[model samples]
Target: MAKFSVSLKARLFLHDHGKLLLLKQTKPNGGNYSLIGGTIERKEFAIQTLIRESQEEAGIELSEDDLELVHVLHKRSAKEHRIVLYFRAYHYDGTPESKELEKFENVEWWSLKELPKNLTGTVRHVLKAYNAGLIYSHLRK
Candidate 1:
Protein backbone atom coordinates (compact mmCIF):
# COMPACT_ATOMS: atom_id res chain seq x y z
CA MET A 1 0.00 0.00 0.00
CA ALA A 2 1.19 3.51 -0.74
CA LYS A 3 1.73 5.69 2.27
CA PHE A 4 -0.07 8.98 2.56
CA SER A 5 0.98 12.00 4.56
CA VAL A 6 0.36 15.68 4.98
CA SER A 7 3.49 17.80 5.14
CA LEU A 8 3.63 20.66 7.61
CA LYS A 9 5.58 23.74 6.67
CA ALA A 10 6.21 27.10 8.31
CA ARG A 11 6.52 30.39 6.41
CA LEU A 12 7.55 33.80 7.75
CA PHE A 13 5.92 37.14 7.20
CA LEU A 14 8.64 39.63 8.07
CA HIS A 15 7.85 43.28 7.59
CA ASP A 16 9.94 46.37 8.21
CA HIS A 17 7.65 49.34 8.51
CA GLY A 18 5.71 49.27 5.20
CA LYS A 19 8.33 47.21 3.34
CA LEU A 20 8.00 43.47 3.02
CA LEU A 21 10.99 41.19 2.61
CA LEU A 22 11.02 38.77 -0.35
CA LEU A 23 13.36 36.13 -1.70
CA LYS A 24 13.76 36.34 -5.47
CA GLN A 25 13.26 33.01 -7.17
CA THR A 26 13.75 31.76 -10.75
CA LYS A 27 11.14 29.86 -12.80
CA PRO A 28 8.35 27.40 -12.03
CA ASN A 29 8.54 28.25 -8.30
CA GLY A 30 11.05 31.00 -9.01
CA GLY A 31 11.10 34.29 -10.96
CA ASN A 32 8.67 35.12 -8.22
CA TYR A 33 8.73 36.06 -4.53
CA SER A 34 7.69 33.85 -1.65
CA LEU A 35 7.96 33.70 2.11
CA ILE A 36 11.25 32.39 3.52
CA GLY A 37 10.64 29.17 5.38
CA GLY A 38 10.56 25.39 4.97
CA THR A 39 9.17 22.07 6.10
CA ILE A 40 8.84 21.16 9.78
CA GLU A 41 11.34 18.45 10.50
CA ARG A 42 10.54 15.31 12.39
CA LYS A 43 10.38 15.76 16.18
CA GLU A 44 10.50 19.56 15.86
CA PHE A 45 7.81 21.89 17.10
CA ALA A 46 6.16 24.41 14.80
CA ILE A 47 7.91 27.44 16.33
CA GLN A 48 11.19 25.60 16.23
CA THR A 49 10.61 24.91 12.55
CA LEU A 50 10.29 28.66 11.92
CA ILE A 51 13.39 29.41 13.92
CA ARG A 52 15.53 26.90 12.08
CA GLU A 53 14.15 27.64 8.61
CA SER A 54 14.62 31.39 9.07
CA GLN A 55 18.29 30.92 9.87
CA GLU A 56 18.78 28.61 6.89
CA GLU A 57 16.86 30.52 4.20
CA ALA A 58 17.10 34.17 5.32
CA GLY A 59 20.22 33.95 7.54
CA ILE A 60 18.34 35.54 10.44
CA GLU A 61 17.67 34.34 13.94
CA LEU A 62 14.02 34.07 14.95
CA SER A 63 12.63 33.56 18.43
CA GLU A 64 9.57 31.56 19.24
CA ASP A 65 8.58 34.17 21.80
CA ASP A 66 8.82 36.89 19.20
CA LEU A 67 6.73 35.06 16.59
CA GLU A 68 3.02 35.77 16.36
CA LEU A 69 0.56 33.58 14.49
CA VAL A 70 -0.69 35.55 11.51
CA HIS A 71 -2.32 32.87 9.38
CA VAL A 72 -2.69 29.14 8.82
CA LEU A 73 -3.42 27.61 5.44
CA HIS A 74 -4.43 24.01 5.00
CA LYS A 75 -4.32 23.12 1.34
CA ARG A 76 -5.16 20.05 -0.66
CA SER A 77 -4.77 19.17 -4.29
CA ALA A 78 -4.85 15.97 -6.32
CA LYS A 79 -1.26 15.05 -5.57
CA GLU A 80 -0.47 16.78 -2.28
CA HIS A 81 -1.84 17.98 1.02
CA ARG A 82 -0.08 20.42 3.28
CA ILE A 83 -0.61 22.45 6.42
CA VAL A 84 1.25 25.74 6.23
CA LEU A 85 1.57 28.02 9.20
CA TYR A 86 2.35 31.68 8.66
CA PHE A 87 4.18 33.52 11.41
CA ARG A 88 4.82 37.24 11.55
CA ALA A 89 7.83 38.69 13.31
CA TYR A 90 8.29 42.43 13.56
CA HIS A 91 11.87 42.10 14.83
CA TYR A 92 14.74 39.69 14.28
CA ASP A 93 18.54 39.61 14.31
CA GLY A 94 20.96 40.12 11.38
CA THR A 95 20.51 41.47 7.85
CA PRO A 96 18.55 39.23 5.47
CA GLU A 97 20.44 37.56 2.62
CA SER A 98 19.94 34.61 0.32
CA LYS A 99 21.78 31.53 1.52
CA GLU A 100 20.95 29.59 -1.63
CA LEU A 101 23.09 31.45 -4.15
CA GLU A 102 22.09 29.25 -7.09
CA LYS A 103 18.38 29.22 -6.27
CA PHE A 104 18.12 32.89 -5.33
CA GLU A 105 20.33 35.61 -6.69
CA ASN A 106 18.95 38.52 -4.67
CA VAL A 107 16.71 39.45 -1.79
CA GLU A 108 14.84 42.72 -1.65
CA TRP A 109 12.26 44.49 0.44
CA TRP A 110 9.26 45.80 -1.46
CA SER A 111 6.51 48.09 -0.30
CA LEU A 112 3.74 46.12 1.36
CA LYS A 113 1.16 48.29 -0.41
CA GLU A 114 2.89 47.64 -3.76
CA LEU A 115 4.25 44.13 -3.93
CA PRO A 116 6.13 42.78 -6.92
CA LYS A 117 4.16 41.28 -9.79
CA ASN A 118 6.01 37.96 -9.95
CA LEU A 119 4.71 36.57 -6.72
CA THR A 120 3.29 33.10 -6.12
CA GLY A 121 -0.48 32.96 -6.03
CA THR A 122 -0.41 31.36 -2.60
CA VAL A 123 1.88 34.09 -1.30
CA ARG A 124 -0.32 36.79 -2.79
CA HIS A 125 -3.33 35.28 -1.10
CA VAL A 126 -1.48 35.03 2.18
CA LEU A 127 -0.49 38.69 2.04
CA LYS A 128 -4.03 39.77 1.39
CA ALA A 129 -5.29 37.51 4.16
CA TYR A 130 -2.71 38.98 6.50
CA ASN A 131 -3.68 42.51 5.65
CA ALA A 132 -7.36 41.67 6.02
CA GLY A 133 -6.67 39.87 9.34
CA LEU A 134 -8.04 36.56 8.12
CA ILE A 135 -6.32 34.27 10.59
CA TYR A 136 -7.24 30.81 9.35
CA SER A 137 -8.12 29.71 5.83
CA HIS A 138 -8.02 26.72 3.51
CA LEU A 139 -6.98 26.62 -0.13
CA ARG A 140 -7.86 23.91 -2.62
CA LYS A 141 -5.96 24.19 -5.88
Candidate 2:
Protein backbone atom coordinates (compact mmCIF):
# COMPACT_ATOMS: atom_id res chain seq x y z
CA MET A 1 0.00 0.00 0.00
CA ALA A 2 1.30 3.44 -0.87
CA LYS A 3 1.22 5.71 2.09
CA PHE A 4 0.34 9.35 1.67
CA SER A 5 2.42 11.93 3.50
CA VAL A 6 1.37 15.51 3.98
CA SER A 7 4.11 17.79 2.69
CA LEU A 8 4.40 21.33 3.97
CA LYS A 9 5.46 23.87 1.35
CA ALA A 10 5.96 27.62 1.66
CA ARG A 11 5.62 30.30 -1.00
CA LEU A 12 6.50 34.00 -0.97
CA PHE A 13 4.61 36.67 -2.88
CA LEU A 14 7.51 39.19 -2.73
CA HIS A 15 5.60 42.27 -3.88
CA ASP A 16 7.29 45.55 -4.61
CA HIS A 17 5.24 48.69 -5.13
CA GLY A 18 2.53 47.03 -7.27
CA LYS A 19 4.38 44.29 -9.08
CA LEU A 20 4.87 40.71 -7.91
CA LEU A 21 8.00 38.59 -8.31
CA LEU A 22 7.64 35.39 -10.33
CA LEU A 23 10.02 32.74 -11.59
CA LYS A 24 10.14 30.61 -14.70
CA GLN A 25 10.81 26.98 -13.94
CA THR A 26 13.25 25.11 -16.18
CA LYS A 27 13.56 21.42 -15.59
CA PRO A 28 12.13 18.04 -16.57
CA ASN A 29 8.74 19.52 -15.57
CA GLY A 30 9.37 23.15 -16.41
CA GLY A 31 6.76 25.84 -16.97
CA ASN A 32 5.83 29.50 -16.81
CA TYR A 33 5.49 32.05 -14.02
CA SER A 34 5.13 30.98 -10.42
CA LEU A 35 5.90 32.28 -6.92
CA ILE A 36 9.21 31.83 -5.11
CA GLY A 37 8.54 28.69 -3.10
CA GLY A 38 9.80 25.23 -2.19
CA THR A 39 9.19 22.22 0.02
CA ILE A 40 9.64 22.41 3.79
CA GLU A 41 12.46 20.37 5.23
CA ARG A 42 12.02 17.75 7.90
CA LYS A 43 10.86 19.23 11.25
CA GLU A 44 11.04 22.70 9.81
CA PHE A 45 8.25 25.19 10.36
CA ALA A 46 6.39 26.75 7.46
CA ILE A 47 7.77 30.21 8.23
CA GLN A 48 11.32 28.92 8.25
CA THR A 49 10.83 27.11 4.97
CA LEU A 50 9.41 30.27 3.42
CA ILE A 51 12.43 32.33 4.39
CA ARG A 52 14.89 29.66 3.37
CA GLU A 53 13.31 28.94 0.00
CA SER A 54 12.97 32.64 -0.78
CA GLN A 55 16.68 33.16 -0.31
CA GLU A 56 17.74 29.97 -2.03
CA GLU A 57 15.54 30.29 -5.07
CA ALA A 58 15.06 34.04 -5.37
CA GLY A 59 18.21 35.22 -3.67
CA ILE A 60 16.18 37.36 -1.28
CA GLU A 61 16.59 37.08 2.46
CA LEU A 62 13.65 38.15 4.60
CA SER A 63 12.85 38.32 8.26
CA GLU A 64 9.66 37.36 10.09
CA ASP A 65 8.55 40.99 10.29
CA ASP A 66 9.02 41.40 6.55
CA LEU A 67 6.37 38.84 5.65
CA GLU A 68 2.67 38.69 6.36
CA LEU A 69 0.88 35.36 6.62
CA VAL A 70 -1.46 35.66 3.68
CA HIS A 71 -2.67 32.09 3.28
CA VAL A 72 -2.20 28.40 3.98
CA LEU A 73 -3.67 25.96 1.46
CA HIS A 74 -4.02 22.21 1.49
CA LYS A 75 -3.10 21.17 -2.04
CA ARG A 76 -3.12 17.50 -2.88
CA SER A 77 -1.96 15.90 -6.08
CA ALA A 78 -3.42 12.52 -6.85
CA LYS A 79 -0.44 11.54 -8.93
CA GLU A 80 2.00 12.41 -6.17
CA HIS A 81 -0.31 11.58 -3.27
CA ARG A 82 1.19 14.40 -1.22
CA ILE A 83 -0.29 17.48 0.43
CA VAL A 84 1.24 20.89 -0.12
CA LEU A 85 1.04 23.74 2.37
CA TYR A 86 0.89 26.95 0.41
CA PHE A 87 1.83 30.35 1.86
CA ARG A 88 2.06 33.87 0.55
CA ALA A 89 4.07 36.92 1.61
CA TYR A 90 3.11 40.49 0.79
CA HIS A 91 6.01 42.33 2.46
CA TYR A 92 9.77 41.88 2.32
CA ASP A 93 13.08 43.75 1.95
CA GLY A 94 15.73 43.70 -0.80
CA THR A 95 15.26 43.08 -4.49
CA PRO A 96 14.49 39.61 -5.85
CA GLU A 97 16.99 38.21 -8.32
CA SER A 98 17.54 34.90 -10.07
CA LYS A 99 20.05 32.55 -8.51
CA GLU A 100 22.17 29.89 -10.21
CA LEU A 101 19.46 27.27 -10.22
CA GLU A 102 19.24 25.07 -13.29
CA LYS A 103 15.64 24.36 -12.46
CA PHE A 104 14.78 28.02 -12.98
CA GLU A 105 15.27 29.52 -16.42
CA ASN A 106 14.37 33.17 -15.93
CA VAL A 107 12.82 35.63 -13.50
CA GLU A 108 10.47 38.51 -14.09
CA TRP A 109 8.11 40.89 -12.32
CA TRP A 110 4.45 40.97 -13.24
CA SER A 111 1.75 43.30 -12.05
CA LEU A 112 -1.76 42.30 -11.03
CA LYS A 113 -3.01 43.80 -14.26
CA GLU A 114 -0.54 41.89 -16.45
CA LEU A 115 0.03 38.22 -15.76
CA PRO A 116 1.46 35.71 -18.15
CA LYS A 117 -0.95 33.40 -19.91
CA ASN A 118 1.40 30.45 -19.63
CA LEU A 119 1.35 30.31 -15.84
CA THR A 120 1.46 27.00 -14.04
CA GLY A 121 -1.71 25.40 -12.69
CA THR A 122 -0.85 25.92 -9.05
CA VAL A 123 0.05 29.54 -9.63
CA ARG A 124 -3.20 30.15 -11.47
CA HIS A 125 -5.27 28.55 -8.72
CA VAL A 126 -3.52 30.46 -5.94
CA LEU A 127 -3.99 33.79 -7.69
CA LYS A 128 -7.67 33.09 -8.14
CA ALA A 129 -8.09 32.12 -4.52
CA TYR A 130 -6.27 35.25 -3.38
CA ASN A 131 -8.49 37.47 -5.53
CA ALA A 132 -11.59 35.74 -4.22
CA GLY A 133 -10.63 36.76 -0.68
CA LEU A 134 -9.61 33.23 0.15
CA ILE A 135 -6.23 33.37 1.89
CA TYR A 136 -6.08 30.47 4.29
CA SER A 137 -5.72 26.76 4.61
CA HIS A 138 -8.35 24.85 2.64
CA LEU A 139 -8.55 21.20 1.68
CA ARG A 140 -8.14 20.41 -2.01
CA LYS A 141 -9.43 16.88 -1.87
Candidate 3:
Protein backbone atom coordinates (compact mmCIF):
# COMPACT_ATOMS: atom_id res chain seq x y z
CA MET A 1 0.00 0.00 0.00
CA ALA A 2 1.15 3.55 -0.75
CA LYS A 3 1.47 5.96 2.13
CA PHE A 4 -0.13 9.38 1.94
CA SER A 5 -0.71 12.31 4.23
CA VAL A 6 -4.15 13.43 5.28
CA SER A 7 -4.86 16.80 6.76
CA LEU A 8 -7.59 17.32 9.30
CA LYS A 9 -9.54 20.55 9.50
CA ALA A 10 -12.46 21.83 11.49
CA ARG A 11 -14.91 24.43 10.19
CA LEU A 12 -17.85 26.21 11.70
CA PHE A 13 -21.28 26.97 10.29
CA LEU A 14 -22.32 29.67 12.64
CA HIS A 15 -25.93 30.22 11.69
CA ASP A 16 -28.52 32.54 13.10
CA HIS A 17 -31.81 33.99 11.91
CA GLY A 18 -31.60 31.98 8.70
CA LYS A 19 -28.21 33.48 7.90
CA LEU A 20 -24.73 31.95 8.05
CA LEU A 21 -21.46 33.62 8.93
CA LEU A 22 -18.70 33.77 6.34
CA LEU A 23 -15.26 35.25 6.02
CA LYS A 24 -14.19 37.02 2.88
CA GLN A 25 -10.67 36.12 1.88
CA THR A 26 -8.22 38.66 0.54
CA LYS A 27 -7.61 38.84 -3.20
CA PRO A 28 -4.31 37.06 -2.82
CA ASN A 29 -6.16 34.21 -1.14
CA GLY A 30 -8.84 33.92 -3.90
CA GLY A 31 -11.27 36.57 -2.64
CA ASN A 32 -14.00 34.05 -1.95
CA TYR A 33 -16.20 33.63 1.05
CA SER A 34 -15.33 30.71 3.34
CA LEU A 35 -16.40 29.09 6.57
CA ILE A 36 -14.79 30.21 9.78
CA GLY A 37 -12.27 27.63 10.96
CA GLY A 38 -8.78 26.27 10.55
CA THR A 39 -6.59 23.18 10.41
CA ILE A 40 -6.45 20.90 13.41
CA GLU A 41 -3.07 21.15 15.03
CA ARG A 42 -1.05 18.05 15.88
CA LYS A 43 -1.96 18.14 19.55
CA GLU A 44 -5.52 19.43 19.31
CA PHE A 45 -8.86 17.78 18.66
CA ALA A 46 -11.39 18.91 16.04
CA ILE A 47 -13.64 20.68 18.51
CA GLN A 48 -10.71 22.41 20.12
CA THR A 49 -9.44 23.57 16.76
CA LEU A 50 -12.86 24.95 15.85
CA ILE A 51 -13.14 26.81 19.12
CA ARG A 52 -9.70 28.35 18.73
CA GLU A 53 -10.15 29.16 15.07
CA SER A 54 -13.56 30.73 15.62
CA GLN A 55 -12.13 33.05 18.19
CA GLU A 56 -9.04 33.86 16.14
CA GLU A 57 -10.63 34.35 12.74
CA ALA A 58 -14.01 35.78 13.71
CA GLY A 59 -13.70 36.86 17.33
CA ILE A 60 -16.44 34.45 18.31
CA GLU A 61 -16.02 32.30 21.38
CA LEU A 62 -17.32 28.75 21.13
CA SER A 63 -17.84 26.10 23.73
CA GLU A 64 -17.69 22.40 22.99
CA ASP A 65 -21.14 21.99 24.50
CA ASP A 66 -22.56 24.49 22.04
CA LEU A 67 -21.08 22.86 18.94
CA GLU A 68 -22.65 19.98 17.10
CA LEU A 69 -21.04 17.89 14.41
CA VAL A 70 -23.21 18.45 11.38
CA HIS A 71 -21.13 17.27 8.43
CA VAL A 72 -17.88 15.59 7.51
CA LEU A 73 -16.14 16.04 4.17
CA HIS A 74 -13.56 13.69 2.76
CA LYS A 75 -11.78 15.45 -0.09
CA ARG A 76 -9.11 14.00 -2.32
CA SER A 77 -7.00 15.88 -4.84
CA ALA A 78 -4.08 14.76 -6.94
CA LYS A 79 -1.64 16.05 -4.39
CA GLU A 80 -3.55 16.06 -1.15
CA HIS A 81 -6.13 14.27 0.95
CA ARG A 82 -8.11 16.05 3.63
CA ILE A 83 -10.88 15.26 6.05
CA VAL A 84 -12.79 18.28 7.30
CA LEU A 85 -15.22 18.21 10.18
CA TYR A 86 -17.98 20.77 9.97
CA PHE A 87 -19.68 21.91 13.11
CA ARG A 88 -22.77 24.05 13.42
CA ALA A 89 -23.20 26.35 16.36
CA TYR A 90 -26.14 28.53 17.30
CA HIS A 91 -24.69 30.11 20.44
CA TYR A 92 -21.42 31.96 20.76
CA ASP A 93 -19.90 35.03 22.36
CA GLY A 94 -18.73 38.29 20.74
CA THR A 95 -19.63 39.72 17.36
CA PRO A 96 -18.23 38.10 14.23
CA GLU A 97 -15.55 40.08 12.45
CA SER A 98 -12.44 39.56 10.37
CA LYS A 99 -9.69 39.49 12.93
CA GLU A 100 -7.07 37.98 10.65
CA LEU A 101 -6.47 41.13 8.64
CA GLU A 102 -4.05 39.65 6.15
CA LYS A 103 -6.09 36.59 5.32
CA PHE A 104 -9.59 38.02 5.40
CA GLU A 105 -10.85 41.42 4.35
CA ASN A 106 -14.44 41.34 5.55
CA VAL A 107 -16.98 39.38 7.50
CA GLU A 108 -20.43 38.92 6.02
CA TRP A 109 -23.69 37.10 6.61
CA TRP A 110 -25.81 35.57 3.88
CA SER A 111 -29.17 33.91 3.98
CA LEU A 112 -29.05 30.15 3.54
CA LYS A 113 -31.70 30.50 0.84
CA GLU A 114 -29.55 33.11 -0.95
CA LEU A 115 -25.90 32.32 -0.63
CA PRO A 116 -23.29 34.41 -2.35
CA LYS A 117 -22.06 33.21 -5.73
CA ASN A 118 -18.54 33.92 -4.62
CA LEU A 119 -18.52 31.25 -1.95
CA THR A 120 -15.67 28.76 -2.21
CA GLY A 121 -16.55 25.53 -3.96
CA THR A 122 -15.93 23.40 -0.89
CA VAL A 123 -18.13 25.60 1.22
CA ARG A 124 -20.90 25.43 -1.36
CA HIS A 125 -20.75 21.66 -1.44
CA VAL A 126 -20.76 21.29 2.31
CA LEU A 127 -23.66 23.69 2.73
CA LYS A 128 -25.72 21.87 0.15
CA ALA A 129 -25.09 18.49 1.74
CA TYR A 130 -25.75 19.86 5.20
CA ASN A 131 -29.07 21.38 4.20
CA ALA A 132 -30.06 18.08 2.66
CA GLY A 133 -29.51 16.44 6.06
CA LEU A 134 -26.48 14.49 4.94
CA ILE A 135 -23.81 13.93 7.56
CA TYR A 136 -21.04 12.65 5.30
CA SER A 137 -19.89 13.77 1.86
CA HIS A 138 -17.00 13.04 -0.46
CA LEU A 139 -15.33 15.22 -3.09
CA ARG A 140 -12.61 14.18 -5.50
CA LYS A 141 -10.56 16.31 -7.83
The digit string of per-residue lDDT tens for model 1 on 33-71 reads 887888889999889988997788778898888898889
* lDDT for each residue of candidate 2 in 1-141, tens digit (9 for 90 to 100): 766666667777777778878898777546677788778788788778888888787787788777666666676655343445555566666677778467777778888788889888777777778778886545454
- Give per-candidate clash totals: 3, 1, 0
- My TM-score estimates for the predictions, one after another, are 0.91, 0.83, 0.96
Candidate with best lDDT: 3
lDDT of 3 by residue, 14-128 (tens): 9899999999999999999999988999999999999999889999899999899999999998778999999999999998889999999999989998999999999999988
The count of residue-pair clashes in candidate 1 stands at: 3
Clashing pairs in 3: none
Task: Return the lDDT, model 1, position 19.
Answer: 87
Which scores better on TM-score, 1 or 2? 1
Cand. 2 Cα-lDDT: 0.73
All models: lDDT? 0.85, 0.73, 0.93
Which candidate leads the pack in TM-score? 3
Model 1 clashing residue pairs (backbone): 25-31, 26-30, 26-31
